[model samples]
Target chain A: SQQGEEDPQALSIQEGENATMNCSYKTSINNLQWYRQNSGRGLVHLILIRSNEREKHSGRLRVTLDTSKKSSSLLITASRAADTASYFCAKAGAGSYQLTFGKGTKLSVIP
Target chain B: GAGVSQSPSNKVTEKGKDVELRCDPISGHTALYWYRQSLGQGLEFLIYFQGNSAPDKSGLPSDRFSAERTGGSVSTLTIQRTQQEDSAVYLCASSAWLPSTDTQYFGPGTRLTVL
Candidate 1:
């Protein structure tokens, strides 16, 4: 069963614009992570936000977590065509070693 | 300095045949995980191994699926009597530890196509 659910299954935006993707999970999590996957390739870790933290940033990526709301959001500033890939949100449940991933949001940054 | 790696980037097998996928995690990493992603679907957890502890096999879908991590470094996932529904991309990942805070490095998945 899936724990996280990302909103806006697919999104298209112009390069240099900001793109925001949202994710909501059903259970309490130890941390939330976002990853990007190029076509026919592996996923690359983008950022991680712990349950105790509300927000984090890495390069052009920003992640916000709301434990009470059981949701998280990922923002990519100044999007590029390289960012045209599927983005996934995964959560590590408390005390569990495995991560449950959500149906990813496919983002297309048109050049 | 190497990242995780998997062999046979693509595989085509008959519906009744078995298949084995290999994953070599980053050196010194103590945690390993396997997940399956069906076309247009989210990743489904398959198994996890942490150090010397027994692996977590709860997420495995059926008795036809089994996995093993030998010497705590390399892992293999075996599917017996594959079915068309078993076709998907099998992804492998590893981390320094089993904690939720640790970032996992993923390997290029093995695209298994059961005919």
Candidate 2:
């Protein structure tokens, strides 16, 4: 089971501040992805970093992977109220069909 | 041009009753997945259907849970003799083909409450 464990079950930050979340997995993985869930219903994919890749950036979101430590981090720079949501880290391993997810870090961006 | 769609956004059933949740994946998407998310918990993989291949049921919690994909498009997840523990938000996602590392478009999810 390559289920990732997200750090800091919950976080609250002021607008314009940066929010960072970390995830650690148990075993080797093929890919690590981040998703944001809003209103507890739909989940939107944020980024995907393969094992071969080290870092990726999309808009204000940045993700770093350290396979040697089996950990990954997601950084949301200059967060806004609209960014308040639950963020999840999921992993896909070689020969694995499903993406195992972590419990997620709940973010609250205050205005 | 639409994303994944799920029917009966909310379902309430008595214990021991049967309920079927429907998922309509995006047009032309060949991979469909079903997952259950309990309150404050992560998404629990339920089943996966890709093309005409056999579904991977390794994540199903029990024999009472089953799913089927028809014509390689729509999917239905059926829970028989449902229990209180079955209460959760059932999410449906679909990708172009496989569930590996590709982005999966998710539906709004069907919230089920087993009384």
Candidate 3:
């Protein structure tokens, strides 16, 4: 599928625990990006991994990409209560200008 | 500098009424996009505008949905003869270039409710 469908539609974890979310796409992508939405508002750009790159990190966020499998994962280390939000993976399809988004994974970090 | 901004944070309209949602992208951004999200769903691409190029309107759901970017800065999405099913949050975003190489900045979405 052009859209990157995320797995484990919902995730519940302790505040100090690490959270991992997975996304798989069928089409080849130029790049994949992870975004976080708080209170269902605007999405904040997290990390982007290009087709040529395997991994990227930003603060407590770690993202890994596997071009061969058309899958990507986002890992948030020591997630806090504030980190409770919906995470989405968007694919910038090859040669296309717009992004195709997936039904996101709702993450709830319990205090 | 300021981030992308949307107007009328919330809207409620009758079934036959039309509503227009506005978006002002960050200054100097050359590309803008419009998306819709129903309750608990992902963003749905609606339309895209690039500098001086024809807009991509393939994702629009019906003839009643239309959008236009004026002077390549502000955009307006109009929905006519609104149905209850049309209730959703409409989001706007902008980027310096294509998302393949740039990050898209999003605005606080406009939540529309049609009765």
- In TM-score terms, which candidate is top? 3
* Per-residue lDDT over B22-111 for candidate 2, one digit per residue giving the tens place of the 0 to 100 score: 999999998899999999999999999989999989889999999999999999999999999999999999998654557788999999
- Candidate 2 versus truth, CA RMSD in Å, comes to 1.1
Over all chains combined, what TM-score does candidate 1 have? Answer: 0.97
Local accuracy of candidate 2 as per-residue lDDT tens digits, A1-111: 437899999999999999999999998898898999987897898998999999999999999999999999999999999999999999988756688999999999999
After superposition of all CA atoms, the RMSD between model 1 and the true structure is: 1.0
Instruction: Give a tens-digit lDDT track for model 3, residues B19-107.
Output: 99999999999999999999999999999999989999998999999999999999999999999999999999999999999999999
TM-score of each: 0.97, 0.97, 0.98
Cα error, residue A38 of model 1, in Å, equals 1.0
The TM-score, computed over Cα atoms with residue i paired to residue i, of candidate 3 is 0.98
DockQ for every model comes to 0.78, 0.74, 0.83
* Pairwise TM-score winner, candidates 1 and 3: 3
Worst 10 residues of 1 chain B by lDDT: B95-104
Model 2 spans > 4 angstroms off = none
Which candidate tops DockQ? 3
Cα miss at A9, model 3 (Å)?
0.4
Q: Give the poorly placed runs of model 3, Cα more than 4 Å off.
A: none
Better of 1 and 2 by DockQ: 1
lDDT of 2: 0.93
Q: lDDT scores for all predictions?
A: 0.93, 0.93, 0.95
Which CAPRI category fits model 3? high
